[model samples]
Target chain A: MQKDSQKTKLRPGQLSRPKNLNLFTIRLPINALVSILHRATGCVLFLILPVILLLLQFSLSSAQHYETVIAILHSPFIKLMLLGLAWAFFHHFFAGIRHLAMDVHWMTTLMKARYTSKVVLVLGVLATLVLAVKIWM
Target chain B: MLIELLTKRYPGMRAWLTQRLSALVMAVYSVFAVARFLIVQPNSYEAWVDFFQPLWWRIATLLFWISLCIHAWLGIRDVFKDYVPNPSVRDVLDKLLVVSLWVYLVWATWLLLG
Candidate 1:
């Protein structure tokens, strides 16, 4: 049959289809960028769980320990690291909310999704900026 | 139809719903926590201790941690499934993830209630 011949021809074409895996060569759309960042930030937040717990325990143990924890957090390098982690949290928070909204049939269109993606990114940065000011000013 | 999707017949749907539900819990908690912190402004050791002293607050915190563990487990499992193609390696990673999440859950429970 003609359909059988077409199927036979398609097999070789599919097998020879070009594959690109180089990450740098592939430009991600805004939604994709937000989506991947959400996952990356989630991993970051999960990995830091132990550190957060340790710091909370240390800060709660005694007055002196609390002071020491405060001092450590206030150090310049640690403050920078904290700001980075805060950004991660903020990004994950906003992007996760956007995803939830989409799940409930809100902003399901491509253009609106892209707009929400930018909103999430900007809100994440804006939140970190506010926290930076709170920390340093 | 919704109940059927969440039943044992459709495990992927169950997992999807769990992830979303856990996310909702955590999101609400995060907002509440920030607002509470701003209002309390726990500036001293005593104040900080007091911030956590309330029994209800501690219970809420525990619930947040539980949601967090569930959320993390599902998220990391999906990450492993996507990136780790080798079945054996993925299995090991999956076990590791489960073990670590349990340890965290235990630690959090002890911290909050112990």
Candidate 2:
């Protein structure tokens, strides 16, 4: 009975703790930013699977449909949206490679990890910029 | 050791390894795809069709799709687990995810092979 009372006093219930749910107040570290973006981009990529499949099917269906798909993709608004999606893909891809590297115990230190995080972000944007240039000019 | 971790006893380990392996596979394929696209410069419909004409290319694409389905399934399932606190709602979403991925797998198979 004494031990049980002590346990209760020592460990207050979870609800008694203070909570701050404001997302804006939370400052995410560089590694954390990359990690969360990886997850977000992953979800975005997964959601677009059906559209990709549909586009692929339509493109392969006939020459007319293929040209139509090409024309749709060549539009200005669609090109911008495609750029955004391309960035998401590039971010996810590079960040994912970083993650796999960490899994194998590479760049596991705080400083090295941060450097690689920056590298991943820069590479993603650089690749997207290259693609944008290829698409436009 | 390695084999032990991949068995049914440690399902999370299996998922972890699977995710990494799939990521590697997709990474290789993505690089190859970009290189091929740049080299082939498939600007016309005929050129594009020819780009996918090789049986080996189709097989590799099919493998990539399979890996994608598995990776997406595991990744999205974890996302739902993390964000969705309600068990029943998460369960429904999980079922929907599996069904949709399976449908996509079938659709991709048909598109690629049929």
| Cα lDDT computed for each candidate against the true fold | 0.95, 0.94
Give lDDT tens digits, candidate 2, residues A1-137. 45665766645553333569999999999999999999999999999999999999999888999999999999999999999999999999999999988888999999999999999999999999999998999
lDDT of 2 by residue, B76-111 (tens): 999999999999999999999999999999999998
**What's the C-alpha lDDT at position B73 in model 2?**
96
Give the Cα error of residue A122 in candidate 2, in Å.
0.8
What interface RMSD does each of the candidate structures achieve? Answer: 0.6, 0.6
Clashes of each: 0, 0
- For the record, the alpha-carbon RMSD of candidate 2 to the native fold, in angstroms, is 3.5
Task: Flag clash pairs in model 1.
Answer: none
Output DockQ, candidate 2.
Answer: 0.82
Question: Measured by C-alpha RMSD in angstroms, how accurate is candidate 1?
Answer: 3.4
Candidate 1 lands at a TM-score of 0.94
- The candidates score, on chain A by TM-score, as follows 0.89, 0.87
